[model samples]
Target: MPGQETDRRPLSAAQLGVWYAQRLDPASPVFNQGGHVDLHGPIDVPLFAEALSRLVAEDGTTRLRFTEAGGVPAQFAAAVEPYVPEIADLRDTPDPEAAARELIDADMATVPDLEQGPLFRHLLLRLGEDRLRWYYRAHHLMQDGFSGHLLQRRLGEIYTALAGGTESGPALGPVSALLDQHDVYRDSAARKKDRAFWSRVMEGAECPPARAGRPALRIAREISFISSEQFAALREFGVRAGVSWQQVLIGAGVLHQHRRTGARDVLLSLPVTGRLTPAARRVPGMSANVLPLRVAVDPDATCEALMARVASAVLRVQWHQRYDASELIRDLGWPADGRRQFGPVVNVLAGDAPPRFGGVPGTAHLLSTGGTAEDLGITVTDGPDGGLRVDFTVDAAYADSVPLASHRRSFHRVLDTLTGDADVPVREVDVLDGVEWGLVVEEWNNTAVPIGQETLNTLFEHQARIHPDHTAVIFNDEHTTYRRLNENANRLAHHLTHCAGIRRGDLIGVLHDRSTTFATTLIALTKTGAAYTVLDPDFPDTRLNTTLTRNHITTVITDTNHTHRITAPHLIHTDHDTHHHNHPAT
Candidate 1:
């Protein structure tokens, strides 16, 4: 028999985050996650009900509720009636499979109330004379992915034993004990060390922006699969590189994100099973946590080197996986203005877990886990045919199907590049598919033009004459009118042509800081019909001098008299006043 004493305890750090999120958005179904199991071969309704009741009576979490224990809300044991599974009979309904799907949809639409006891709910639908579908949903505060998997097996055993006129195995302790263990972990020295490790990992790191825009409803999803050959190649490559397949996938994901955002450092949120002890594993509660994986993707690094770094990082993080994600974010001292620390999350599902229910042989299918809580969520699972299925749930407002489609294509291309040639540097990998390459080479860059008598300077002159009073450019508090800019460029053009002997097809070097004078000089180059070369002032003297010399003779134009690095025949310098004063009309 279970203890009669009230098992009360504070919420775990992860649970506290979930509670706060639930309280903030009461209508969101993100925290409500569940799966359904298909039980074939005649489910005895009454006996199944009794088994569900017995299971609830034995497990303390099923009969658990939340209330104010001392000024703060905490979980405690609640005395509630035995859970009776709701039965939806659709055997006689037309299109039984379709009708059964409607019943499942309706049950999933009903959200659970946290304040009420029995956070876990169940629904059994009759598909035909011998087919039954069982759906189970529980608040994330009570269950994780592993717990859901374990529950299906446990229910199978209970129903099987009852059907055989026997009893199931002894029940375990209350989930409240798991919360107690979590509290103990919070106060341990190991937790302090984990905290320090995360602090170092996340220091000076900013998560990348969402690849897609946020949709109004934000409920779009896409699933892509990789070939069995590619999946096998990934594993074989991992073995050769001394890394796990998960780390290899993560490394590939980081490289993908880098190619997408052009960022050297990538930060991703990864989910880990927080089953720190064997007792916690059997308790069937919310023992999963999300942690940040920060990696620096050096473009010059080889694929093996990058995978090795990711593997080492994964191992170190798993050692300190007990650190509370919510608390770690708090300790990072980031602003609390409703922005999440990470934009994308990657999860690997337990697809290999066998469906062990009773003595009957049937299949278990999970209808839905909660939709993504982040802008983009990628879930990987092993397919029934031994391949890998990757589902991407994205916020539509941030990204469209077009880009994500290409993203999926590029992801495969990247994997091929990595496994095809391990010696190539990451920067050398080309993610574009063959079609994209053909388009770029044959269509996009096919820039053929008709010869025209008109020049760029003539076009600008026409626009200035038509809209002379229009604002041409604004830099800081200064504005240049079209007429004024045209006259200024004409003045510089005359100086270049008459004074500096600049003519058509002459190559001139123009070096200046970002200002109105630089714009004027570029326009003047068009008027003189001379090809102009631009250089950043910040480039090293050796590179600048070498580039100037390799390009041959040069006449340099600048806003300042700093031409010591460039060996030029003539140097023309000009400056303009940018002190908020608008240039008067020409």
Candidate 2:
């Protein structure tokens, strides 16, 4: 075993990618993968400990560590002693369950060092004489989602036999065999073909739009959404359409993204089980790869048609999913910039059989790592009674800023649309349900207000009369009271009415920067019963001249600096004597 520990090997493509990511962000726990399972009515501590130790000795990944040798990342089986599972006795605590939860939370908050040996750790919390909680933490470099379930099954099986006073079965094979097979697959022509297929799928593909105002990097927040009744209908529709539940769920996700982004061509990263051969399933290592699943949804296509497209896309990628995503990205020549390759990721995990440890019903809870590599990721797990549980892990930056409620509601709405009718066109389908529609119509769009034929100018005048000393206009450090604004506007109005022979309905061109002068001129124009058009300072001179001439505006009120540009026959520069006109005994 000591000699075997000296053997170093190159990591698989997927593992290499994760290693680079860890190197890039050393503090992130996004790649820390593990879970907690609670087993009630457990009494055989000795047997459980022995079974756990035996399982670890059998799985080489449990003692594996990753590091850089000669500037190249490599993994080796550490010459460490067999893992002795730690036991936390919380039975004497006031609230055993709460204490156990706190212990589990603390364990999940920490991450293991990859450069160090023993990438996995196990703990058994003694909640009470009959209650036990098992916490297993492993890095993604050595384990996948299915590996977690396998760990539970193997632990349960070993415990069952040992507790029953019988000898356990022979130890399972080490993860080295799986790595050997991966090496073989890496050199195979099939792998090359898969890479080609991926290149075609991702050619010229633009990165998905980032959520507005969301930070580029942050810890992940995991939340679970369960759909029992609605999933029943979704399952029924899948059966009727001759598609798998995975396809239906993926179609719904794609539809939700389409409605969320209004992008007909949507791209998502999908995690596919790379356990193509039976040998891959037995080995405990990361044999999964994330591939791009591109769905082209036609607005006129029916729900059935969209599902069919989803099914076809999924089927096409299934065989080629084992292709190394890192290599594929490199071959595609994606920029090395910080932008992500795709948008949200959708992972439909394999349905795990309910684990029972030593005749005690154990429920598995996948703990969050509190970090994510994508903007968002949705992991769909099978729930009880043929329902589906969706665990959404989103980047904290996005979770805090984006309104995912609308997306959640719209996801169910898409499911409803698909299950409610078989032949309904996707374009005609209402992605918003009744409540969401009400939110849009009743809550958001309630813009009705009584209008008693009062114009903005009349309202301003009334406010000026009532709040004469109130602050009316403020620009930078300059402020003007309502009385001052009204008085200045009245002076201008008098000049326009008497000196310029301004008549009602006359169009006046107002050209000024954002200041009190602009405000005063607008009010003055209204007071003189003449219409005013604000001229854009950025507009071309020819365009401004054409607009003034086309509108038949004879009078222009602007600053002295802009007076030279005005083509109107009558010009009243605010900085000139025109504004110094007496109030004329108002």
Candidate 3:
């Protein structure tokens, strides 16, 4: 990869994570951005081409799969060639967008790269004979926010080295070795302890605040932002109350939902940075995972009480992020086949570091909350001034109406308690808006169906009613009917309670895979009025044993064909017909 100069630097690990994330998100503009990348500057075309080739060659851990390893579907260089002007005289147009328009009409955008990836082509606009700003517009498949940063940083360094007559560059270290090393670490004994740590945090988990369906949240064209004075006041209040900015925001987020949907129990899916371990922090990819923090408050719950619960849940989730999102979902027994059950998420990544190169004068003030559920997302970015810029993208159906606006205002007031100090606990702030107070009060008085309760089981039962016969359990050639589902559940219930001494208040733990018995056991446990815990067989034996001991589980009902092999008082294999229904002495 040689032209004449410059060995470029590569993207750091954290930046690369964000880059790959955009690749996976359908809603991301990056999903269709690859076709629009254009490189413009006053440098030798051959030199820049070589620079780009070198940039791709440096081999950031994640990019190699799509770059040089014979792994991706197409050559990135070829897809990019069309975007380069054959021989255009360079000067800045009054608007960079004008150049963008011409390039799109040129049909260079249709070219594909990396198989499924779109072409990453760019038009070189000569800027002052020495510098350039590569006007980039590419589908996310080619690059993400972080990848762009990596490219710019490395390109600048490469150009600088070339100008200085350096024939060699700093060789790339064992970067390619990181992926396999990480995989090995993931399956290691240390990872087992980490998994156990997370399991403890999610022991009695619940889903977060979300609307039932996929109806999109309304996004406003014209948005008036909160003032600096208002944000300051909130910061002061949060400090006095003893919670972080996040707790304060979460409290306010719950209030917004209550005002918008009239639901009270706040189950917000808050995103946490998934990079926790020392090793994880070094390799960057989309490592943000979420946790469902349950905030149970009556319509009359003071800001203080609500904030406290949200804060505690946030702490535990952060401490246990090692178990990634996929692991958390399975442990929670949530469906992953794309029928969305998880609620809307609230993410705050306020650090000011967008993609920038040495030539660019100022930093690119990019504020994005990556990919999120089609629910209400409250993203707080570092504002132009010292204040915070908070963007709330709600599902269009739940637009901020009059009542919702008032709830939004009241939430800001809670932040008012924080203006004096940057830190204040969420619970200390008070929501005293008369209209909002009365609206929530009326809902509470009119019916016991409080707003918070709706955030939980209310919709679940309705889903069951609507889709009862829709393949509740699909075991090998044996589908359990919703009707028969409950009957088999009762049979298991009688067997557990009467024969195995599992009573109304007992906790029965089932080690399982996705099967009819697992579903039936779940139903039976519900019927018997006993709480049951599900541990995937993939979980380490030690971890499962810890849950058993912690929950005081005496009987573990699993099948012999699909088993835990752990000892219990009565190992009742479902394959056996010796199902007894006699009640054991309580």
Candidate 4:
């Protein structure tokens, strides 16, 4: 592909918008695991420098040298010229490890000093002979673990290309157009279709799903495959088994964490890049959104079978991506209240490392960071150098990072065994590490609030003493008196219990409103020890009937106005029947 590589050019507005939004993600650097990288021996200076230059050029955002604009996005460059330390007489430092530690400290400090702009991108530091550290504090935005690793891969490719006597640079396209992409997103088929869907979804609804107002000081972690070779086999195996690489990973996570924690289900706020169009290069805000997948597993389900189920369910949701997620949540009657409504998120980033920049002979390590609510995340990267590195970020309180690190190694073993025995049941794959078991068990055995709490009730009532003799419901030129309404309620309650087979805990479908008949039905149901759930008269009858069936609503109590729409075995109406032996009007 590099043989067809194109030279660097400025990003079009659309590409710029996308990069701007991504790099400027205010909630990035989501992970906090950074350490020194010590080469086994002296580094190749010429090879490294050439690699850096080519990499900076390929990504566009990195090619920039700072100008004194004080901010990155406001202008396009840094506030000052970058300084690369001279490594000629660096003998005073103990060794590469000590030097790397110093480099990290300096990088951390400089990160905060980066004034939300260009200089924060990264500064390449040469420690001494055979040692190098790229130091610069990065907000979780400009790059993520997947992208970082990709960038490194690209860099190595470019470097190797240069080393192997090919310096013209990798092929390219116009700088990706991010802003145009955003504009296109605004007018895209999905956007237009979703707008209509959202309006209808939210029409006349007061209560909506709830969320915590503030972003918590968050920490996350992920355990992914540690062997590129095994991952490759897993890839082939996943295809043959009709599952995605991501589902395989998610299944692995569920198995690893559920078995240890005894959790039968888990909720994950999966993030989607929302890169659904060429215009995806436009609008740079949080194009990334979270989809809460409420996944549950039957205890008796084997890993292979469960994986098949998970894959299908996951694909179904993703395929229906045209719906407004917020609307879907409301329509599905999910909890809007911010009480960990579903569960913590688990993400699978197939990783976006550059696609083999020039095909290099080096390894790239990527550590993903930030997204305030990511409780746990897993990122997979395919380095050109034939290696796989797994990074972990965990809630400090839940488990030890060391254990996760240990499992990363053990997962490699599991991967190998699974791949070696493609037909082997997933559970039979040897799990050498106890920590992996613990995490899985904890995930499978959840402690979230039960179903009853999730779907709750809220009642509102008031007296008209505030407005004496006020008209409540005006129907067919007749006004219903609140006092009179209350009286009818008492009368109906007696009749419903004594004649209409009403009892405690029974759900009475109340198809009414502020209408006089509505008030009466609500009060009547309460007396029978029954709860009345309202169904808006204007809503489709099919929808209303579905609710009735789901809630086991036996009595459909309405006025004569609804006779044509609802005809159940037990339909009770007022005014239509007067003296017919008023034996409870059944």
Compared with the true structure, what per-residue lDDT tens digits does model 1 show for residues 1-586? 1233265566776677667666666676666677677766766877877777777676666765665566776776566565677888887888888987776666666667776645777887788888777777887777777677767767777888888877767565567677777778878888888888888887766533323222332345677887788888988888878888878887787777777667788777777778767666667777788788778889998888888988887777777777877677667654332335464677767345556445565465554455445456667765545677777765444455335666777777778877787667888877778898788688899867663776778889989999999988777567898888888888778878887788999988877767787888899899989998896654444555666788874677865545675666677777655333323121
RMSD values, in order shown: 10.3, 11.7, 10.9, 13.3
Candidate 4 — which residues are off by over 4 angstroms? Answer: 1-47, 50-92, 105-116, 123-137, 144-146, 161-176, 192-246, 254-267, 276-289, 292-302, 312-344, 348-360, 379-586
Segments in model 3 whose C-alpha atoms lie over 4 Å from true places: 1-56, 59-178, 208-266, 277-284, 293-315, 337-342, 353-361, 367-370, 394-411, 420-586
Ranking by TM-score: 2, 1, 4, 3
Best by TM-score: 2
* Candidate 2 per-residue C-alpha lDDT over 1-586 given as tens digits, one digit per residue, 9 for 90 to 100: 1325468888887687677776766766666777788776845887788889988877777777888889998888777585789998998989988987787667666668886746777998888778778888888888877788778888877888877877666565668777887888878998878877887887656545444332434454445455677777877888876788778888888888887677888888887778787757777787777778898989898787888899999898887878876666556545333325466777776356777776786777776422365466777776645567676666666776545555666666777788786788777766777887898879899867675787877788789889998999877567788888888888888877988787888888887766777788888889889988998654445556888989888778778667777688878777422234443221
For candidate 3, what is the TM-score?
A: 0.50
State the local distance difference test value for candidate 2. Answer: 0.74
lDDT for each of the candidates?
0.71, 0.74, 0.50, 0.49
Give the candidate order by descending lDDT. 2, 1, 3, 4
Q: Which segments of model 2 are wrong by more than 4 Å?
A: 1-5, 165-170, 209-218, 337-339, 369-371, 382-386, 400-402, 433-586
Model 1 worst lDDT window (10 residues): 209-218
* Model 2 poorest 10 in a row by lDDT: 577-586
lDDT at residue 403 of model 2 (Cα atoms)? 50
Cα lDDT, model 4, residue 97: 51
